[model samples]
Target: MHKEGDEIHIDEQEASGGSKEGVVRWVLAGGLILAVLLMSIVWIIPAMTQGDIEEEATVSGEISSMEGGDSTDSIVGIDGEPGDGGEVTQEDGIEVIEN
Candidate 1:
């Protein structure tokens, strides 16, 4: 019912029309997603880096061992010699170990 230019303008306006509420909802949704992503990064960064702190807490200047082992070692040339003492004998209610 109008000129070609008028019809085209009317169609363009109709196609481009968007509700204000819809735009607000999209912006809010995007903001919520961004906030969640930022929160995850904040939480994850510290969680990944906490291992170093735990390791530092467990460490000291002198090296400590976790495995069970003897506290003393007999040197090859020192304690390997045979003993000159006679063999010891244990009796009832008594215990003995020969050198």
Candidate 2:
């Protein structure tokens, strides 16, 4: 009867010990997830935002002029006359049509 009591006491101790380790593991996992989220917001989000701005700047720079020369005069529309719908005309020796 004493041996049976001792075994039950040991089992109770083991159960408590296992529960403590489980709680510690859960806390550590929660802490790691929090750290990752914080790092992403602080570092990754800003970098992504900055990347979009940089891409826009690059696109604007590319559109400023074509490869060989200044292309401002070579381009038309918006600055030129608004076209009559579906009308064909000749301008700058190029056929202009609005469809």
Candidate 3:
């Protein structure tokens, strides 16, 4: 009869130890989930939702000089009023086109 009581007490102790380990496992899992959520909000989400860079040129009446480049330097210019005979000249690192 005494041995039966001892066995019951041992089983209870083992059950409580298992419960503590289960609680620790849950706490670690929750911490990892929270860290990932914060990282997404502070870094990943903003990086994914950023706007792309765009360049546009629009000419209405007359344009003096317009410059744009992606991997090289390029310039477009019209040096006088419309219908005025314009001279196109080439300079170092500049390109000119006559229309």
Candidate 4:
């Protein structure tokens, strides 16, 4: 019952609605891609490209004397005698002083 012009007009309206829907879908897809790119740049790229901290070196050494002597016989203190007020004792009895 509709005229030819009326049917053509209705088809045009439907086509315009379809085009609008397509534009909305494309815009949403573009927005999702942009969000993913920004997240990668902000959070992932920096962590991947970061550098490590530098370490320091440590040193150690020991002391030695050239004089060949009985280093173990070195006196440290005096032992206390029964009457003469405690006798002077040396560390390990290695008497450095002949008292």
TM-score of 1: 0.34
TM-score on alpha carbons, each prediction: 0.34, 0.34, 0.34, 0.33
Candidate 3, superposed: residue stretches over 4 Å from native:
1-9, 12-21, 45-67, 70-99
Which pairs, if any, clash in model 1?
A: none
Give each model's whole-structure lDDT: 0.58, 0.63, 0.55, 0.54
Top lDDT hit: 2
Please list the Cα RMSD from the true structure of every candidate, rounded to 1 decimal place: 13.9, 9.3, 11.4, 18.0
- By TM-score, how accurate is candidate 2? 0.34
- lDDT per residue as tens, model 1, 3-90: 5754633454456684444788899999999999999999889766775445455544123432325435423333324564435456
Write candidate 4's Cα lDDT for 3-99 as tens digits.
Answer: 5854633556565665544788899999999999999889877666554321111121112221445556544434444553446547786743333
Between candidates 1 and 2, which one is better according to lDDT?
Answer: 2
Better of 3 and 4 by lDDT: 3
Summarize candidate 2's per-residue lDDT along 1-99 as a digit string, tens digits: 135644733555565664544788899999999999998889877656675446447656456434647456554453345562355578999886655
